[model samples]
Structure formats: structure tokens, C-alpha cells
Target: MPRKGMRSVFMKSSSPSPSNSPSRSSTIPPLSPRHTFSESLMEENIEIAQSLITKWDSNSQLSEFSNINSLFNGDRSEARQYLNSVKDLQTAMHYFISHNSSSENLVRAQFLMQTAMKRLEKEFYRILSTNRESLDPESVSSRGSTISSLSDFEEDLEDELRTAGESISEVERVSMAAMADLKAIADCMISSGYGKECVKIYKIIRKSIVDEGLYHLGVEKLSLNQVQKMDWNVLELRIKNWLNAVKIAVKTLFYGERILCDHVFSASASIRESCFTEITKEGAMTLFGFPELVAKCKKSSEKMFRTLDLYEAIINLWPEIESIFSYESNSALRTQAINSLVKLGDAVRTMLTDFESSIQKDSSKTSVPGGGVHPLTRYVMNYITFLGDYSEILADIMADWPLTFQSPLPESYFPSSDDDGPFSAISVRLAWLVLVLLCKLDGKAELYKDVALSYLFLANNLQYVVNKVQSSNIKFLLGDNWVAKHEEKVKQYAANYERMGWSKVFSSLPENPKAEISPEQAKSYFKNFNAAFEEAYRKQTSWIVPDPKLRDELKISVARKLVPLYREYYENHRVGLSRECGSESLVRYAPENLNNYLSDLLYGNGGGGSISSSSSSSSSPSRSHGRHGR
Candidate 1:
């Protein structure tokens, strides 16, 4: 009676009755687990189960929890163990419920499966809760709660579970659930001001995870400084270990959610809290103050090596500090790390500026307890040297930025760069910092009461900074153009010094034979030359230049400019000049003498020269660049 199309459809769509299907027939060979219900049979079973309810019978089909043909057992412990032992519990339950069972029986199977999962979940949490209670603050402290100690404790506790006949995996599953619970507890402990205890558990998890094999991933939770004076090596090792644990927890707990579809308490986010201490309640957003600690350490170190200034000693240290920032693989955490560094840099800049401005508040404010170099100059040098130290570190920080970045320098932190120079954004930033320090130095130099000494100090320090930058790796960061420009500034300072300090001597030199001087004027000229030459030479011989090459270059520069003209003027008019002051006595420097004079230009001389320091020469001690030579 069926239509032709309906008959064809029925033949194709219908599955054989349970008695007729090849798989269902007792005569057929068993499907060795790999064989499964066809799609239609699975759909038919799920559809039947969705439409009815069956008895929650604890006997008959539910009587065993063994092989596939075995039924579920009634004992709760055994049922709980049954759920725990299966590698794919959900898959097993789904297959059992949807393969040829009546709809009502399939529903009953899902209910029993869920019941077993809940029982196991409850038992797991119960055991771990007891373990946590036993690890109260006093107990944790007594054991000294190291990662290894906690690890040993975890092992021993889980061993007890194994002794109770739980599988190794079942104990671990329970422990993982406990660890998940510990995350919230740790967060609460931290939030409630029991951060120290939270740290203990954090270490426990971290150390526990090392064998878990994860930090071929990366992971800070602290004002890194608060613990700086602590044994950082041990703390660092623990941090690395803790990072591994977090990766494992995140992955594993995520697995629990996917496989068991249970309320797996993931502590992965809270795991971060255990890594570092925080100043505020903002959790992981706390800027790790380690980078700032590093910045401060460099500033402190500058006091020990004051003469060399800032950058030389500090540059080597940046690598270690920057590594702290780089170690945090989490992008959000790294941003906090960078903010801490920027805060440090800004703080340092403020320090330098405040120091300089305070000096200016009353130039007569007592000098700090150090020798020779003026306190103001020392302050400027420290800033220059220390900032020079910071320059490369900042450049390194900036190096991660795009080369095309045109972002302005961070507030009070970055240095000036030569826009015209071929350098990266980082390079430009370094240049800007250098320029800022130099500008401050130049301003301080201007404050010197003696116009000539101002030029001299400025010239020495500027040349020193330029040479330091050029000789170090910072040179490339600053570019050749920056060096050249600053070198020109050094020269400009020297030129100013020359015009202001030496012009009188050059003026006193005799001119053309056509312009005859009266006897009074000639005598006056000789007297003036004696006064000027002796004064300049005596004042500078004892001032320290420090660097040999800089010393030589300045000496050569003086000779190149002074020797030729002095010789020309002396030769042209010596015969016409007065001998009243005595030519030998009047001429304090011969051409050869000039060579010795200039060679000792940068270093302070101990008044060692052929030039006489007669009663005519000023007796005042020249204290501009002290004899603190290296």
C-alpha cells in the first residue's frame, strides 16, 4: 500500500530491528571496541531517551562497573572510583546511553553518570580541604614552607590517598582540584593582608610544576625592591618554577572543563598574584618595582665612581635590569614592568633636576663631603655620567619600538637626538638625553663667577661627554653627526675660553714695525705680557683633565692656535721692544716652551714649568678643576 518514493525512503532510512541488524545478532562476532553504532542507530537511541524517563534502578543493568558488558555498581565508593578510573568518562557514558538502549534507560544512564561525577568531585575537595586546614599559617611557617617542602608534603599526602587504593591518577586529579581551591584561598589571603602565606603556597605550586615542564613559556608579582635585599637567587628560582606550575594549571584545568564539564576552579589568573608583592590592591597591575630598584642601584653606584660620571658604570648594569622586563612573557605584565622602569627613569631625572635646582637655590649652600671638583660641577657630572648610563638603557627600551616611531620622549626621561643624524628612534632618544644633560651643564658653567673659568669648565666636561659617547657603544646610538656637533660645541667652548683667557696676552704681543710704540707704552706692553702669561699658565697647570687623549688634544689645540701667532709677533718686534723688564724674563714662553705648556694643558700641573711664578704671578689657588687626577 506504500507509495513508490515512500517505500524507497523507508528502505534507505530504516535501521534493522535489534534482532536483525548484523551487529545486534548474537551470531555476529563482537565489535572489538572500535566498531560503533551507525549514525541512524545513535540518533534513534538519543531521540528515544529524550522522550522518556526510566527507573533509577541500582540493580540489574546497573549491577556492575567493569567491562562494557558489565553494569553499573551500587556502592558509592566503587561508583565514584568507576568515574575516576575511566580516561574518557563522558565518552564512555555517552556511548553507553546512545547505543541501542531504550530512550528511558539512556536517560537513566546519564543521571547515574552525573551522580558518580559529583560524588567523586565532593570526595576530592573534602580530602584537599583537610590538607589545607592542616597547613594553617603556623604549620606552613614551621616547615619553612619552601617549594620543595610543600612539594614533599603534597607527595606524602597524595601517597596516603594511593594507600587508600585510589589510583595515582585519581590522587593527582584530587590534588589538582585542591590546587584549584587553593587559588581562591590564596587570593583571599592576599586580599586580606596575609600575603606572606599566599607566597608560601605560590612557591609550593611553582615548585610542584617544575616537573610539570612548562616554562619554555614565561611569567612578576612584586615591588621587586622589597625583596631585593633578600636572597634574590632563591626567589628567582622559585618564580621560574611557579611560572611552570601556572602554565600547567591553566592547561590542565582547561582540560577538566572540556572533558568533565565540571566547575573546575582555575587559579591560573590568581597564580600570577603569588609571584610578586603589591603596594596597592590592584592585583597584577602593580608595576613591578624591580626595574626601578635597578635604576636606583645605578644612581647609588655613581657615588662610588663619581669621577667617571654616570653612564660608564651604569651602562653595564642595564642588561641585567632590562632582563627583568623581558623575562615577563605576559604582555600585560610586561607593560607594568615598563611602566615601573619609566617611573624609575622619571624619578632619577627629577632627582637630578631637583639636585641642580637646590644647588641654585643658594649657591653658597654647603658643599657635599667630597674633594676638589665644585659640588655644583660634581652634581652636573654625576647627572651627565649617570644619565649617560641611563641613555643606553632607555635606548634598549626604545629599541623595541618601531624605527619609524615619532613619539615624543617620555616626560623628563629621554635624551635628545640629532634629527639630522641617521639613527633609530632609540638612538634619537639617547641623543636627546645627552643634549639635556649638556644643556644643564652649560647652564651651570655659565653660573661660574669667572667668565674665563666658566668657558674652561664647560669645555672640559662637554669634551669628556662627547668622547665618552663616541668611544662606547652609545656612539652608534648617537650617530656620527651627534658626536661631530657636540665636538663642535666643545670647540666653541674652547674658542670662548681662548678669546676670554688668552686675548690679553696676544694683545700685548708687538705688532708691525710701521707702528712705533713710545717707551712708556713698550714697557707697559712687556709688563702686561708678563702678568697675563704667568697668570694663565699658573692657574691651569694644576687642574686635572683625567683622560690622556683629551689632555693631549687640548694641548695640541692650544699650541696650534697660540704658538704660530706668538712666534710671529715676538720675532717681528723683539728688537724694538723694551728690555727694562728683561727680554728673557718678559718672554715667559719660547716656541719650545709652548710645546711643554700645551702638553700639560688638560692635567693640572704642580706649577712645574720653565715659566716663572714670580712675585708678579697671582698667588690665589686655582681650584676650578682640582688635582683629583685618575
Candidate 2:
């Protein structure tokens, strides 16, 4: 629509001359209004059309193939004027078609417009190609920081350039200039009805950049069959590469490209959106679709951590995915990302189920030597402890995959009510896994021949579990209360081990050490205590507690229970027994000898105490003293 002022100007210029005007020759009949208007419009269009040819006739040598000079590079004002001339010629062509369709001026205008578009097409391609580094997505996106409304974008851009001032580097200046040039050309070409040419060039150049970027990031479009056929080692390396790539892809590469596309084609909303879609859609799909392919591959327990890592990477980058691929055309990219997350979550859940099943199905009947930590105990505890690192993500993934046990776990197995929080699901899941291992361990413990060694096996394995939980991220997921409860179970096992292993020794001691007794009775008591203590020590010489803290605690617990009472009994009965006995060896063990014997237990060193030796002495002075003092 022409403005009212333009309409008035056309009307005035096309107004008919007075019929009786003296300047008009009588033979020259007055012209009709239609004829006069058509002639006036044609003349006006001829002038407008003439401006296009005149403006560019001198610059006609600056063709698409001219490499020495750029139409937009030298003078900012001149470039802007060229755009206005093209716009004016577009308006002229419209008027000519409505008023004088066969006019040569329209042909000229059309030709010049093509000439201008060709020049712009060349500029667009040149700017994109030559300024690759300056106009990279990262630089462009960072300059914008966050997308502002399109209406204020030019203002924001001006403020940015103005603020950069003399401190702007040569690359930054080139980038800003290139951006302005490209946007100007895009706006001019689109207004002149050459948007397809401009957009086609843009898509070709930018899509290449995007494709190359993804290629360098090690993202590839692997089919499910290819991924399935891949060896685990190769697939694992790919997964690690993807884990590192997804962050940069979402945060910088794709994000920056979106910003640049939107900015350059700001004049056309539909063009920018479509261009961004076509440029980034395939690369993004391939990037995000990898996890789903990996999930679809042969599932295994060993691959669970990598699957979880993929899931975590996607979940963490979701905000960027949503923001950058928000276009309706690019919804597939968003859906692909979501689908990868879902598949990864499923893989993780499946791996969890398989792991738990493997634990319960463990059929090893061989008991651990000397009641040491079981291999299954070490494997499962180490695995679950690592699972604790992903507790936050697991909570989300496991929200739907509830723990389903045939029978409820024991109350002691549950974390206290105060331990409940956001990660309760993961905590329960991991806790259930540990419980599965424990039940399996229980079956393994029954294989041991000695009931006392069975208790010791349970204690050693559970102590390992507790230590693993405490040392890793599992400590936070399974709270202090859970740890404390398990620790108490370990204590109970240790206590049972002591009671079952040393019952005879405890029974051999007199009820009251200070009671009056005959020398014969004292000798019998001394003889019985020596036999029981020596037998217990000999039997437990090969037992082991691998954890130093638990080992020391168990030693202290046993020594505290046995040592003082034996010390009192020996002190009261020593002289009377010595008087009755033919040799002093009957009152053989000094109180310090008990401490020495206890030190040798649980070390897995099969050496007996010095009870039979003529000289009974402490081999480890510090260890003996510490045990005695305890």
C-alpha cells in the first residue's frame, strides 16, 4: 500500500490539463484521464527504474565473480543506499506491472533486481565462507548472550558494537561487520523477493559447519545394527566420546548456530526457523539418537555405568535442548533427546534388575577361606557404591521402577524414617541390592564347616559392606542411621563368633577367682584354663578380618571379655597352684600372655601362641600393650 502522500503526488502528476489552456495546441486534443494517468505512472516508474540502472551501472563490474572488491565492505552508507535503490526498483516494477505491463522499464527493473540479488548472493556466501572463525556460532551466540525480542535486536546489536569501542579485536570487528553485512543483504534480498536464493546459500554454508562440528565431536549416525555389531570396547569408547560431546553440542554448537541463524534472518521469522531446522536437525538427531541405539544393543551388567552416564548427560543438557530446538519443525530433535533419555533410563533399570537377579542366582557353594570377604560381596558392594554417585539421576529413572520384592525386607534393612528424602527410591533400590547380596552371602556362609567360622564369615563380609558404604557416595544416600544399623549387625556377628568359638574357654574358668580352695582344686583350675585357652587360640589362628578397624575392634572386644577375668583368676590361684604342682609350668600363662595370644588371632597368619614355650613373651610390643590396655 502506497502512503497517502504518494497517492497525492500520483494524483497531482496525473491530473488532466485545462481543456482550453493556451499552451495546448488546438490540434492536440485533450487527453483522457485514464490515458493521462497511465502515461504519468509510466513516466514515474521509468524514472524509478532508471535510478536502479544508473546506481549500479558504474558498479556493474562488481559482479558475483569479482574477488577484488565487495559491495558492502568499503562504505557502510553506500551499502545502505544500494539496498534502498533495490527496494525502490521493486516498488517501480509493481507499479509498472499494474499500469504498463509491456513497458521496457519493467524489464530493466527486473534485470537490475536480479543483478542486485546475484551480488547479494555472492556477498552472503563470501561473508559466510571467509569469516568462518569470526562468525562462528560460539562467537555469535555469546555476543547475544540470551535471545532478546526480535524488535529490539538491532538496538541490542548496536549497543554491543558501540560498547566494544576501541578494545574490540580485529576478529571481533570483522565478525561484527560481517554480521551487519549479512543481515543487511538478507533483509534486502528478501524484500526484493530473492529470499530463496539467500536462504539456500545460508543453509548450504551453515549446515556444513554444523555437520563438520558434529563430526569432530565424534558424533556419527550409526544404525542400530551397526551399534549392535560393535564390540564392547569400541562401543564403550564411543559412549565416552558422546558423553563429552553432548554437553558441547547442546550448550555451544547447536545453541550458537540457532542464535546466528535467527539473527541473520531476523527479517523473516519463517525463514530463520526453517533454516535453523534444516541446518541442525540431522546433526542433533544423530547426536541425541546415539544413546537410544546403545540402549537397544545387547544389554549387560558391565555396560550399566556407561548407560547411566549417557542418561545423566542428556538429563543435564535438557534445558539447552528445549531452548535451542524449540521450533515446531525441530521438535523431532527434542523428541529424539527425550527418547534417548527414556531408552537410557530403561537400559539402566534393566541393568539393575539383571544385576539383582545375578546376585540372587549366584550358586557358588565354596565358602571364602578363613571366613574372609566373598568375591560376590566385593563385586556387588563396589558396584552399588558406584551407583550411589548417580543417586540423583537414579531417583528420577527409578521413580517408575519400584523395588518389588516377593517378601518385605527385614525392618533392620530399611533406612530409618529420618533418612527419607528425594533419593529414597535409589536408596531403597541400592539398599535392596545389598540385601540381595547379603542373602546370597548367607547361603554361602552355610557352606562353611565350622559354625563359628560361618559367623566370622558373615562378620567379615558385612564389615566390608559397611566400610564400602561409608567410604563412597553411598554414605550420603544410605544415611548415618543405615550405616550405624549395619555396623551393629557386624558387632552382633562378631559377638556370636566369639561366643560360639570360645564357649569352652569361658566355661573352664572358676566362678570366683578369690574364693578359698585347696591346692589340688587350684591346680585343676589352672590345668583346665590352660587347655581351653590354648585350644581356642590354636583353632582361630588362621581366621582373618581384612579391615584393620574391624580387626582391631574385634580383638579388643574379645580381649575385654576374656583377659581381665583370667588375670584375676590367675593372680588368686598362682601361688597355691605353684605349691601343689611339681613344676611351675602348670601356672603357665601370665596375664600378659593372654594379650599376646589375642594379637595373633584374625591376622590369617597360622601361628600359635607361646603357651608351650619355656619363654612366653610378646612378639609385637605395641600391639600387645594396646590389646592389654584395652
Over 128-176, each residue of candidate 2 has an lDDT whose tens digit, in order, gives: 9999899777776676753433232144556666776888777777777
lDDT tens digits, residues 1-630, model 1? 545454344334444556545554354444434333443344454344322211222232543422222112222333223433321334444654444333454465466444433333333334334554333222322223222222211235344544656443443444433543444333333333344544544444333332222223332444545545545455445444443433332333222211111112122334343242221113223223334443444333233222122222224433433332232333455455455546554544545445444444534533211112344554544454444454545444444443333675443233243343334555554455455555666566655655766777777777667766766667655567666777787778767877886777677666542356665565566668667776767656655555566556666666787778766655555556534455545544455455544554545545543354322122332222233331
* TM of each candidate vs. truth: 0.43, 0.87
Minimum summed lDDT over a 10-residue window in model 2 is located at: 614-623
Global Cα lDDT for candidate 1: 0.45
Identify the leading candidate in terms of lDDT: 2
lDDT of 2: 0.79
Model 2 stretches astray by more than 4 angstroms: 1-67, 98-103, 146-163, 417-420, 579-582, 609-630
Q: Which candidate is the best by TM-score?
A: 2
Candidate 1 runs further than 4 Å off:
1-443, 446-449, 471-479, 513-528, 547-550, 564-590, 609-630
